[model samples]
Every structure is written in C-alpha cells, then in structure tokens.
Target: MEKVLLFFTAASALTAVSSLPARSFYFVYEPKNWTEAQSYCREKYTDLATIESMEDVDILDNMKDLSQMVYPSDSYRAWFGLYDDVSSWRWSMSDSDFYQHDEKEFRNWRPGQPDNYQGNESCSAMYSDGSWTDVGCSYSTRSVCFDVKGPNSTFVLVNTYMNWTEAQSYCREHHTDLASVRNEAENQKVKELIPSTGINWIGLYRDTWKWSDGSSSSFRYWRGLEPNDNMEHCAAIYFQDSGRWEDWNCDKKNAFICQNGFSQKVVKLKLINTSSVDLNDPQVLENLLKQLKQKLKDQGVDGDIRLSWKKQSDGNIFMKNTEDIGSDRDVP
Candidate 1:
C-alpha cells in the first residue's frame, strides 16, 4: 500500500509539470522589432495570444507560472488583446477566432479605455491595474500565444482585381469565396499570406458580395480605374502584391488570383512603383538595379529587366518585363 501511494504521488507531480505551460511558450525569447516579433511569433510560436474570455487571459497569465511576472524592462510597453478600434476586438494573428465576450466578470478593458485616439490605433495592451489600453500595432512587447483552430478548417481563396461574377466563380470553383476579414487578427493573417510585392484584392467591394454571415465590403482596396461603373461589386486578393487590396467590377475579368490550397502559389508580383523616379539620382538607380539584379540572379534566370517608356508619348507609360511569366520559373 505504501509503495502504491508513492507511485501515485510521483505520477501526479509529473502530470502537473507536463501540464504547466512554459513561459517560453508565451513568447519567443529572442527580442525583435515589432513587425519582426509578430512575424517570428507567427512563423515560430503559435499565433500571438488571443483571448476568448477572462479564462483565456487567466490561461495566458498562468503561462508565466514558474517565472516571476516581471515587468517588461526594455521599455514602457506590453502587448494587448484588442485591435481595429471597432466593436470587434481581434488577435494580432489572422488565424485566431474572433473573441466573443460573454460573462460580465471577465472585462479586459483598460481604465478610460479604447479611446480610439486618432482612429489609427488597432491593438490593445494591459496596464498595471489589469485594465487594457489601446496601443499601436507597431509597438513591441511580449506576446501571448494561441493555437490554430482545427485540422479540417476550411480555407478561402480570392481573386484580386476581378469582377464580382468572376470572383464568385473563382471561389465556387476553388471551394471558397472572397475571404471575409472578420477582424484585425484575420487581417494580419491575410497580410501574412505572402511576401510584399504587389497589390492584393480583398473581399471588400462596395455593398455587394456580402457573405451569408453578414460581413460587409465596408473595408476597401480600390485599383486605379476602379468601380468601373458601380457594378464592379466583387473583391479578391493575391500575396506577392504587397497585400494592398483593390476593388473590381463583378463582371470585368482580371488575372490576379489567390488560393488557400496547400500547394497553390497565390501571390502575384506587381511592379506597381518599379519606375525609376530619380532620372538623375544615380545612387537610387544603382540600388534599384542591384536589387533587381539580385532578384533575377536568385532565380538563376537569364532574364533582363526590360524597360519600355516612350519619351513624352501623350503622358502615358507602358512597360513590359515578362520573361518568366507562366514559364514555371519563379522570379524570386
């Protein structure tokens, strides 16, 4: 009997230790800039911490169980649990589910909080008083952690710069629709979908293409010649395109596309501002040429940066550089 009791005690202690969340689990120990930190946390740790209720806050707090709850010594800063100043509070990561407030006992607001100071702040933080304060997305601080929702999670694909009908067709054919960015975290995740290069279409187009869930196109990313007559009511996004969204007519067709497939490459590279602005700026041109040369060299291609600009041709600019377009050759 004595031996069995001792064995039981040892088993219980081991279970407790195994269950205890590591402080390192709360954040990646390596310090990084705000953007890099967010990126690191997303790429390495689980998505930045998301809170569903006060229970989640408590879980995250408990993540620091073994270590002292030390104040951030780097600066007067801390990561928080809110974003986008709207009624919707989102996690910094895109995959996090939208937080739903239920119990009255688990308030996460900072005193005099969520003031929407200048309407630009889209993140939240906690203060010494345990209240949450509005902060900038670029602010660096320790982050909370969260896991992706599930295994069979459905992924949506979008077509940036597509007509509403074409966008709908693309979604139907690909088994998804123009993705609804529910909150900042989702927006953040969408932003992380690809490398920064060109324009990405968002699921936000005027008043049409509203999902069955009531998400609106209130948020917009319009292309240069957009609205094309108020009928261009659908939206889509691509990754290589700097995540900048654009609106398009539902009937007009464009090639820009996006996908959530495991093997699909959904980013579209756009030379939106590749124009050499400094005609006389040697350094700027040199740097641009170097970067461009590196990009070409990295791909191990013999392609050249083709430049096409007619001098004073009715104030119009037309350029073409498509040596690797659709050749199964990636342009780095």
Candidate 2:
C-alpha cells in the first residue's frame, strides 16, 4: 500500500455566488411611524426592506394585503427604506489628498440655488462670475478639466459642449478629472478659465436618496411629480397608484415591509489524494468535511459554510489515475 498525500490543486473548479444577501420581504400590517417601523424590523428581521429593482417592487406589490391596510381615503401605502439624505452633497473628485482642511466643504452657490429643481438637479455648474448651482445632469454645457502633479494643479476649460457624465469622462481621459473647486482660490482659478458668458459643468454632484440598510442602489420608480415636496423626507410605495413610489412625511404612521436572509456562496474544491485510505468512503468523507469546515472557521471565515463531495458519473467522488500513478483526484 503506497502512502497517500492529499493537496489542493491549482486548477480546482470554484464557483462563487453573489455576496449580496438573499432577502425575503414580510409585510407587517401593523401601522407604525417610519422610525418605529425601522426599529421593529431591525429587532425582528434584518432591517426595513430595501427595494433595489422593478422586480423587487413587483414582489412587494404582490405580497401586500390591501384589505388589511385600512385608511379613510382611497390611497393606501406601505413604508420601505428609502429616505432623503439632506447633507449628501459632495464633489466628484473623491481623492482626499487633493483637498486641504475645510476645502471640501467650501461652497459658493448662488442664493436660492440647489433647490434640486423638481427633484432632478443632481449635478453642479459654475457661472462665469464664480458662483455654483445645481442643475440636471443631462443638460449639455462646456466643462472644466484639471491636471494635478504633486501639490500643483492646472485647470483647463473644454471648448466642446457635453453633459456632466460626458464631461467627466472626457476630463478623466484627457486630463486628471473634472475640476474640483476646493476653496475660493481654486474656485476663482476655474471660474476665470470659463468664457465670460456661459455656465460650465463642474465636479460637484450628489445622490440625495439612500436606503436604511445602506444599499447603494440607484433605482427610482417615482410617480409623476412625486418627491415634489421637500418636507416629505421618507419614501413609500402607493398601492393604489400601481405600486409607484411617493415621498411622505416620516411621522406618518403606515404599514411597512421587512426583509431577512443571509448571503450564500458556492465554491468547488479539487483535492489530490495520495493516502492509502479510500477517499470515497462515507466515514472518511464526513471526517474530511468536518476538518475542512473547522479550517475555514479557524481562518476567520464568517457565516455558515456547507461542504459536500461531487459525485462522478460512476457515483464516486474519488477517482484513480492510471495514467498518472503519482496522484489520485477527489472533487468536492
């Protein structure tokens, strides 16, 4: 009987499922304010539901019990986990080293500007006079690009008119990135580079809406003129309005949704067996699985991990290699 040494091979087949947690939404008919609902969900399940796509919206719509959602008017709603983050504004140039202390907070916005006109203005533009204003990202305009070397930076005005996204791409490809007006001096330098007449796109932008569980989904299914009120900071799905989203006051009590589940991952492993003991034996395989699981835990791998052997066409997990007598193969 030859001694068998088991080792993992480099060509092992490995499959990884998405790390995002699999969630199941539960509709709680009990009316509760946004804050209370959030607390209940956190204590009972994972957190308030974070709908990421139209498919998720449909799921919620199907699961909701409209008869239980009693109200005086025809409108019926349920709170999920979307909210307006009033202080989410920031510059597109994210490199922290490029900005000095308090430079990132510097703002020279024109008065009564950045009202998020109609809840669509998420990009920033610079006037020839050196003031900034929030505008729709789709609006085409001339842009300023900047190049940075060590502690020095140079601002260049792009003569071509383009949307904010296009301008950002052009700037990144040709120069460093869109010009970041860190302070009054940098703002003045960028403003001087612009033509004396028209407004130009800048590096400032923001995403006002966020999920309670901190999901970074940009999906929005708002109804017409929805999110129109600035005072209504929280979001809900209106059942009567074809499940479209609407901004509502956070204090308003309503039924809510909660979600639960852990993220799952799948991995395939191949082992080279050099032991005299049969690797395919049920007792031996179970012991090997236990050892592998313990090893994973010892290495600080969190969450539940399941291990099982992969059976071949002959229903055996371990196969002898006659051509390569030096090694036997086991799939798991």
Candidate 3:
C-alpha cells in the first residue's frame, strides 16, 4: 500500500522570508570635511573606520541606498582611515590605539598606488571594489562607520612650541586633538621631554586667565614667568626640573624638544627656612647652608647626605650630592 500526502494551502510566507547576511546593514552618514567626519564617527559609532582588507572595502562599496548628512557635497567618494603620505602616514583622526588592530594588507590600492602625489596628498578614500583614491586633506566627502570589535587607538607625541590654541589647531590639521596628560606620571614624563628655556606645547591650554587641560585647567603648576596669557598660552615642563608649568600663545612658532624613557626616579622634599639672610647675599653662610641642602635633595638623596660645595665669583655656591636609601628615616 502506498500513501500520498498533499496540502492545498498557499500564502506569501516563503516570499516574506528573504535572505540576509549576518552583518549586512551599514549606516552611511552625510559627507563632511575630514575632521568633522572623523569626529562624527567617534561620537556615534567608532573611531574613523579602518578597512582591514579588500573584502572589507568591497563590503562598504556595495551599499546602495546612500544618503547625505552634515555637509552637502555631491562627491561620491568618502573618507576612510587610510593614507600613505610619507609626511604623516598614520591615521590622523583617531586617539584610539592602532597597535592592537590586526594589521591589514593594502589590497585595494591601484598598481604603484599612493606615490604621495607630488608629496602633498595625505588622505585616502575607497571609490569601489579593488579601487582606492587619494585626495587633498581638506576635501569634503561622506564617511563610513565600522563595527570595530577590538582595541583601536593611537598615541601622539607633540613636539611643537605653540600656545595651547595653536597646538590644538596643528593637531586638528593632522586629524588629531591636542595632547592630553592622562595621569601624574604621564604629566611628569611630558615635562621631562621639554626643554628648560622654551615651552613645548602639551595638551594644556589657558582657559581664560587660568591654564587648563581641556578637562581641568583650574588645577595646574605654573612655571616662573608663565601663564603669560598676553604673550604665551601654551605650557611645558622640563625633565627632572621642579619649578612648574608656563603658558604661551598658540600661534608663536618655535622648535620643540622631546625624550622618552621609563618613570624618572624623583626625589621629593620640603625646604625648611632655618635662618634668614639678606636679599643680595644668596651665598652667605646662613643662606648657603640651607640652599646647599636643598640642592643636594634635588639631586636625589636623603639619608647620610654628602655634597661637595663650590663657590663662584658671583657670590653663588653650588653643591653636588650622593644619596643611598638605607631603610628608615629614624635609623640615622
């Protein structure tokens, strides 16, 4: 015996169940200048999107129902985080760490691509699958968002002598914000990277008459003759020097200096006035003794402080000291 099962039911159920990729829908924002596009993506989705492969670029290239936002440029190409200028090759718009992102091959650049276009063009775009183009840094265009899963960041080392405002503008031109000191250790390290005579612009700027990091300008240590809002509006600290910070105008152009290393061993002390001396006599026995002790402390010493003194013709005395920590402050 054979049995046949038949159903006479028909609806649009199969047609309504259309197929879709697991991650297909990508949101497209309106065209914008490179800076604005970068800011928008960071605020909404992620840092400026970085396409890891030709396949990834192709995925974005295939989007159909594109719309515009922010700027009203009719240009079809949009900015992505890829550039090959020998001047500034890294992504200019992100503070996010780039070291962690899995390095991707540049498979989309045309043959002999990114020759830097007479050493000027430092920006890149994805025109279509297996196609990429370089554009001027200021050209406006739409930008894409990425569903970045891992850590994506960048580090900036500012080596300019500008007032805070000027430093910021410079960073913006390169698609980065002013440098921010995240911690006390980082601040110390920054100070050490600068010179003693000139101020190197860090992220700190003068908010009104007070020096400030964008987050907090109220709290700061101003160097002598600094926070000179009229002349200087930027700030920098010398390596291992214990004076403070200074402010300078952002526009004044000057060369900057920097150094990198592990946490600098610092020696902290309180200067106690044991005796009084005349204003003119900085090397008098009373003043000389106290000053020498302080100088020795600054050279990184505490217990069994030993120093050799030298008297100069200008009535100034300098001291050299050596120190070794031997357990307790009360031991000696």
Candidate 4:
C-alpha cells in the first residue's frame, strides 16, 4: 500500500501565546519627527511605542540610551505613540442601537468652539441655547440624564453638580445614561432641561490621546504641568524626568521608541497515514486539521492557532512516499 505523506504548516494568528509578553519596546537613537517615526515603526515593527502600564514604562526607561542620541536643544525627550485626536467625538452611551443612521455623528457645536482649550478640554457641555462646546472633564457642572423605555426617551436635569465622569456615573446609576443628543430636536429637548443661563454636562465627549497601534489603554504617566498646550499634540518620554511623559510638537525631530508584538511562527508537520481514508480529500484534510488543533489544545497549546496545508508544485498536499513507512512525526 502506498503511504501518503501529509505535509502541513501551522501559524499563530492575531492572539499571541499567553506566556509571551504582549509587546516589546525598542528605542531608536535616530532622530525623526513624530510622523516620520510613526511611519518607520509601522513599516518595521507593529507601531510606535504604546505604554500600557508602569511596567511598560520601566521597560522603556531601562532600554533608552542617552549617549546614543543627539541632544536637540539639550532636551532629553523621545517620541512615543500617544497623540491627540482632535476629531474623535462620541457619545457616552456607546450602544449602537441607541443611535440611528448618522445620528451617532450628530453635533451642535457653537461657532469657533470645541477648540480643546489648553489641550485638556476633552468633555462636552451643552449651553442654554442648545449649542455644545468641549470643556475640561474635571469641571463640575449640572448634567442632563436620559431614561429610555422602548422607542420613547426623556431627558432629566440632575441638579447636583459633578465632574463629567461623576455625572456619567450618577446618570448610569439613576437613569439609562447621560443624554445623547441625536438631532436638533433631541438637542433642543436636552437644552430645555438646563437653566436658561447654565452650561450642563451631556453625553458627548472625546478621547484626547490615542495609541498609534490602536490600543485603548487608559494608562498615563505625565509630568506635572505637562500637556498644557493645545499646539503640542504629540507625546514623548522624558528620560531626564524619570521617564514621565510630556506633550510636544509633532514637527520637532527627536529620537523615538517603537514596539513589536509576537510574530507569526510557521511550523511544518508531516503525518504518516495508516488508514485507508483519502488524506488529500478536502473534507478529510479539514477534519484532520480540526483533530490536530484539538490535540494541540489538549497538549496545552494556546492562543489563536491557524493550520493550512502547503501544496507542493503539482498542487497536491500529500505525496506517495517511496521510502519505508515510518511512524508519524513532525518534519520541523
């Protein structure tokens, strides 16, 4: 009987193995502006550095070599991934079902408003005239809350003054969520709830900083009085200040840090088929892959594992072995 030698390869998918670190940081001494550094990182690695926690900060702090970098104006700073996204406005109630069509993108900003004054105004507030403006999230103000019952919704004004986050919490605990003004009508409805001269908190808000790799990490380690300027939208790590973060102009050239995640590993496997089943048959090959995946899972292999058969030049996944049949074993 001819022995079919099944050759296949397995690769790691999007999720890396649990034992491996999520990201590895690299400090590049070459001076490049923030945009240039970002492009380089995306081309060579995953993206510019995305510091997720204090541990990541420490890792980067130790990896930086000040002697290798050229001091630009005696500044001991290096660009990382955090950047201000000035147009990322969204509602606090993020459930897609709550909005219709472009209602999610609805805005009633006052003219020349939402300028993100001082680079710290990341929250939205509605005035008595039904216009919205971005304000600092820490500003205490009365908030408008909403209660939804089926398709009907009603706005309520919370008389107690609180910060944006506190108001969101209060509204969530007491009502459906903070008021989401979906249209001119809803904006007017919410505006009516506020006092004629009051600026009240609404569900509209925007994230000031975002990671280059699109990671939603809220971790921040800023130096005192840092990120105080609206023009300085890019973030950098200050080696001289114990690796604390500071905002800078993106156009300024500086040494930068990049991060990389675990790469996909291609593994070759050879299987000796002893049964009479057609090993190259599409259904048979698919079943075999499922069984192999289960076997790997049973043997403690984790993460997203993807298996595919590598067809030879003749377009066949399995070839008849001329040598003596041997026990099943992986080729590499």
Count the clashes in each prediction. 23, 3, 21, 0
User: Per-residue error at 225 for model 1, in Å?
Assistant: 23
Alpha carbon deviation, residue 122, candidate 2 (Å)? 0.4
Alpha-carbon error at 174 in model 4, in Å? 2.8
- Every candidate's CA RMSD: 28.2, 12.1, 32.8, 14.7
lDDT of 3 at 268: 22
- TM-score list, all predictions: 0.20, 0.67, 0.21, 0.69
Error of 4 at 228 (Å): 1.5
lDDT of 2 by residue, 221-328 (tens): 999889885668789889988799899888888999998864443455555565568877888777777767776678565455666666779988767655543232
Clash count (model 3, backbone only): 21
lDDT of each: 0.33, 0.78, 0.34, 0.78
Model 3 stretches astray by more than 4 angstroms: 1-25, 66-74, 84-117, 120-332
Q: In candidate 4, residue 90 scores what lDDT?
A: 75
lDDT of 4 at 316: 73
TM-score pick, better of 1 and 2:
2
Could you give candidate 4's per-residue lDDT for residues 165-194 as a string of tens digits?
999888887887888888888888887678
